[model samples]
Target: MWPLPVRPERSYSGEIRNFSKLFGTERNRFGSLHKLTLYYLPIAIFVAVYVLIILRNLRWFRIPVWTIMMAGAVAMIFSGAIPLGDAYASINLNVIFFLLGMFSVVAGMDLSGLLEYLTLKLLRVAKSPQKAFGLVLIGISMMSAFLVNDTLALMATPIMLSVAKQLRIRPGVFLITLALGVTIGSTMTAIGNPQNLLIALSTGIPNPMLDFLYYLAPPTLAGLGVTYLILRWYYRKEFANSTLAQLQVNPREAIKDRKLAKLSGWAAGIVVLGFFLVGIAELFGIQGNFNLGTISLLGATIVFLGSGRRREILRSVDWGIILFFISLFIVMQAFWESNALQSLMIYLPVLNRSDPGLSLVTIILASAFFSQLLSNVPFVAVYIKAMQAAGFTGADVKAWMALAGASTLAGGISLLGAASNVIVLEEAESRGSGFGFVEFSKIGLLVTIPNLLILYLFLRVL
Candidate 1:
C-alpha cells in the first residue's frame, strides 16, 4: 500500500524484522557452538595463542587482555590439567553470586548516599589533610578487607578525585594512595579478590575466610604500619607542605539524601550480616548449606525490591567484567586440557615439593617479582595450581599468605606493576599533573624492600 518512494524504507524494515527473527531462532545454535568451542578447541588454540603472545611478543596487538585470559582458561578446560574444573565451577558460581549480592548491597548504599556521608563525616572529624588522608586510607582498607577490591577502587577513586579537585591539590597523590590502600586491604580477607577466591576454592582448608583473617590480620596491619612509616620517611617534606587546607567538609552538602542514606545503610548492614551468618553456618558445620551464589542473588533481589531502584543497581553492575570472567573460565578449562600446565610445572624446578618451605618462599618471591613484570592477577592465576601441587602445609599456607601480601602490596613498586597505578597515572595525565614512573618508584621502593623483608621473616622464621 506504500508509495514507490517509501517502498525502500518499508522493505528495509521488513528485512530487519526477518533478520531479527532468524537471529533469535538461531541464537541457541550459536550458544551451543560457543560451548563446543570452549570445550573442544580450547587446548589447541590456547597453546598456539599463548606461544604467540609470550614467544612472539604479540601483546602489543590490539587484542584485549581479557581475550587472552579467556584463551588461557579455555586451554585449561581442554587439557583437564586442573582436574578440578567441576569443583571450580561450583566455586565460581558461588563467587559470582556473592559478588552479585555484595554489589547490590553496595549499590543500594551508594544510591542512599552513605559513602558520601561517611567521607564528609570523616573529613570533618580529622584535624588536618594528613590525618584525613590516613583516616580515609584506613577506612577504605578495612572495608576492602571484606569487600571486592575492584569495587572499592572503582567507588573510592571518583570520590577521591572529587575531593582532590576541591582541595586544589594534585589528585595524583590522593588517587594513587587510595588505590594502593585498597589493593593492600583486599588481601586481608578471603573474599576480597579473585586470587583469594581461587585459593579458597581449590584448597581443603576449613573456614577459609576465618582462617585467612587469623593469619593475615597481624601481617596486613604490620604492612600498613610499615607503609605509613616508609611514606613518612620518603615523603616527609611533601607531607609537611601538602595540607588540605582548602578542602571543606559539609555532611549535608556531601550527602544528597540523608533518609535514603539511613535506609541503604540499614539494608547494607543486613546483607553483610547475612554474609557473616553464612560464614558462621559453614564454620559450625550446619547441615543445610546455602549456596553463596544463591545467597548473593537473593540479597541483590531483596535490595532491588526494597529500594525500588532495580534499574540503577543493575546499571552499576559490571557485565563486561562478568563476561570477561566467564570467558576466562572457558580458557582456563582449555589450558588444563592441553597438558601445557603440567609441562610448565615440570620445568619450574622451584616446585620440587621436596623442600616445601623453600618452595613456598620461592613461590612468594617469584610471584612478587613476576607481578612487578606482568600482573598480580594473572600471575596468581597461573601459579595457583602449581603452588598447590607443590604440597604446602600449614607453614606453607602462612608463606603463601605472605607471598600474596607481597605480590599485591608490591603493586606500588612501579607504575606498571599495578592496574591501580596506571589508572592513577591516567588521571594525572588528564589533570596535567606530572607523575612519572621514576618518581613513583622512588616512593614505592622505600616501602617495598622493608615489607619484603618483614614478609620473609614472617614466613621463614616466625
Candidate 2:
C-alpha cells in the first residue's frame, strides 16, 4: 500500500522555506534573538543587580544583596547566557569552603565571648581617650589582619559601642574608626578578608601568606598610624580630657563560656600557626597539597568536635555572605563568558609586562575605583581575570600585592565599598546608633587617600 508521492515544492524543506518567507526567516530571527539573549542579556542583568544592591537601603527596594546576586545568577542561567553545568562549575568551592571554615571558627570565638574578652583586654591598656582611640584602631586592625575583617567587624561593633559608652562619647567616631581599621588591616594578609583570600587562592601565587605580609604589612602599619593621627585630629573635641582610667572595664566579665572560649582561642591560634607553617614550608622549597582552605577547615573541625555549643556557633555563620559569593561567581562567569567586558577592557590602562612599575600604578588605581562599585571581592574576582588577560601572571608578585592592598584600602573610600563597612553599619544601626553614608564617607575619604598613597609608595619601594 504505497502512499502517493508528495510534490517536490510541498516537501518538508519547502515548508521550512514557506515558513521563512512568511515569518521573515524564522531561523535568522531566532538566531538573532538567541545572540541578543546570549551577548547582551547578562550585562543588563548584571547592571540591574548592582543597581538593586546599591539601592537596597531604599525603603521601596529593601532586598538582601545575596538575594539580588542569586536572582541575577538564575536569570543568567534561564536566559541562556550560560549553561547550567557551566554555572555550577563557575562556583569556586575552595572559596566557599574556606569561608565556611573561617566563619565557623570565628563564630565559635564570638559566641563563646572570647573575642570580646580579648578585645577588652587589649583596649584596657588605654589610660586616656586619645590612647584608647589609638588602641581601638590598632587592636582591631591587628585582629583583622589575622581574622577576616567582615567577621571582626561583626564581633567588634558591640564591643566598640560599649567602649564608647564607657568613654562617655558618641559611638559614631568609634564605628568609623573600626570600619577603617578593618579595611586597612585586612590588607596585610591573605586570610584577612574574603577578597584577599580569593586573590591568594586564585592567583596561584606561591607562598601567598608570606608574600602578602612582606608586601602589605608596612603599608598597613603606616596606614593605621595615619588613621590614628587623622581620627585624633578630626575628633579632638570628643576625646579631649577624656580619661579611661576613671572608667572601670573588667575584661574578665566579658567571658561567657570559659570552656568554649579556651577551645576556640586555641583553635584560632592553631589556624594562624598553620598558615605560617604552610608559608614557611613553601619558602624553603617544600610543597604540599594542603592549602589555606584545608588548614581552616581543620581548625573548624577542631571547634566543631571539641565545643559543646557547636550548633550555636554554626548558626552564627553568615550564610548569606557564603551564598552571595556563590551567586557572584555564577553571575561573573556568565558575564565573562558573554564577552561583555572585552570592549571595556581595551580602554583600561595597559598592564605592561615589561614595566611592572607602570602596571602597579594602573592596577592600584583601577582596583581602588572599581572596588567601590562592585565591592572588593567581586571586583577582585573580575579583575584577576582582567589582569591575566593583560599578560600578568602568578609570578608578578608586586602587581598582585598591589591589587590586594588597593582593593582593601578602597573599602575605606565609602560606606558601601567593603563588606566590613556594611557589617559594622548594620550592627550599629540595629543597636540604635550608626553613622550616615555621608558621615562615613567624609572620614573615609580622609583615611583612604593617605592609605592608598602609603600603599603605593611602599609597594613601589619594596
Candidate 3:
C-alpha cells in the first residue's frame, strides 16, 4: 500500500471539530451539520453537474458540459472537500498531453484533407446502401482502433451526412452507425479512447496495446459484425430499396495539400509504429520507460515542424475537452477523498477477488450501469482508485482488462454514456441534422447488450 501523506493539526476536519468545541451547548447539532456538509456536498455537486450535462441542450438553459464540470470542481475546492494542492495533483498530465498531441496530429490530417481522401476512397467502393453501411461500420471501426474514437467521430460526422444525402437515405441511421462503430472499435486498444488510456496508464499494464489486442480484439470484431447485422435488420426498410448514386468524385482530388498530407501521414504512421514497437518490446521481457503520451507528443512535434499550419492545428485542438478533463480530475479526486464513494461501495456487489468469473461479471455490470450516470471517463477514473484500494494490483491483468472493456462498451448504453456520442451529436446538430436522445438510446440499448455479452464471453474463455 502507498503511504498516506502526513497531515498537520490544522487540517480542515480538525478545524471543524475545534470550532464545535466552542459552542458546547449546540456543538452536537452544529457538528452534525458540518460533517454532513463536508462529506455529502461533493456527491451532491457531482450529481447536479451530471444532471445539467444531460440537460445541457435544453432550449432555455443552454450550457457547455465543460463549464458544468468546472463549476463542480470549483465548488469542491471552496467547500473544502479536498485541499487545493491535492486537487492540482489529481489532474493526470499524461492523459492531457496525450490528448493534446493526438488532437493536433488529427487536426493536421483533417486540414490537409488526407483523412477525407482516405475515407472517401474506402467508401467509394460501395455500389449499394448495404455495402456502404457495412463499409462505414467496418472501416470507421478499424480506423478508430488506432486514431481514437472521439477524433474519428469528429472527422466522420460530415462525411456520413454527405453519404446519407448521396444515397437518398436518412442520415440518422448512418450517424448512429458511426457512433456505434467508434465505440466498439475503440475497445481494442489502450489509446483508442480516454477511459482505456486511463486503465492502461494507471494499472501498470506491461504491454497494454498487445494485451488489449489479445483479449479484446476478438470480441470487438465480433461486436462489430453483430452490430452490422442488428442495424441491417432494424433498418431493413431503409436498406431494402436504396442504391448508391454515381458519386462523380475522385479521392485523389480531395487532398488540399499533397505536401502537408504526406507529412501528416508520416507523423501518424510513426506514432502507431512506436506504440506497437514499445508493446512488442515489453512482451519480449525487455523493460523500457516508453509510454503512449511520449510517442504521441513526438508525432505532434513532427507535424508542427513539418507542416506550416501550426497555429490552425493548435486552434483545432479541443480546448474545452482539455478543460473538462482537468476539472473532472479535481472533482473526482475530491469525491473519492470524501469517503462517500467508499461508503456507497459497501452496498454494491462485492468483487470476488478469488473468483475471476464472478468478479468479471460484477465489474462489467457495475461499470456499464455507473458509466451511464457518470460517463465512462469519469467513472473509470474513480473506479481505478477503488480497484486499487480493494487490493487489485498491476498483475491482475484480466481484472483491469475487464474494467476497460465494460466501461468502454457502457458508452453504447445511452446518448450521454460517452463523450464521443456527445461529439457526434453536437457536430450533427451544427449541420442541422442530428439524432434524438430517444432515437440514439433505442439503438444504443440494442447494440450494447450483445456487444457486452460478446465482451464477457471473450474475456472469460480467452
TM-scores, in order shown?
A: 0.78, 0.92, 0.88
Clash pairs, candidate 3, are none
1-462: candidate 1 lDDT, tens digit per residue: 765564333447888999999998799789776655544455466555544333322335555455665555555545543455462662366656766777776776666667767777777878766677778777777877766676666666667877767655566667767766777777767777656765655555566666677767776788778876665465555566656777778877766556656656766666656656766887778745464456556767767666666788789875645555565555554455444576667555476557657765676678667777556655665676666656664334665576566677767677656555655555555656536667778877776777666666665654
Q: How does each model score on lDDT?
A: 0.65, 0.87, 0.86
Error of 3 at 176 (Å): 0.8
Error of 2 at 167 (Å): 1.0
Tens-place lDDT digits, model 2, residues 250-276: 889888989888888998999999999
The lowest-lDDT stretch of 10 consecutive residues in candidate 1 is: 50-59
TM-score-superior candidate, 2 or 3: 2
After superposing all C-alphas onto the true structure, candidate 3 shows an RMSD in angstroms of 9.7
lDDT per residue for candidate 3 within 1-462, as digits (tens), equals 999987866658776877767677487787777777678887898778767876776688788878998999999989888899999999988788788888888888888998888878877787777887898789889988888789889988998888888777788998988998899999999989989988887788778889989999999998999999999989999877677764544789889989889988999999999999989888788866666888889899999998888898899888888898899889888888877777756756687778999989999999999888778987787788778778888888889999999999999989889989989998999999998899899989999999999999998998
Candidate that beats the other on lDDT, 1 or 3, i.e. the better one: 3
Each candidate's root-mean-square deviation in Å? 14.6, 4.0, 9.7
Which candidate number maximizes lDDT? Answer: 2
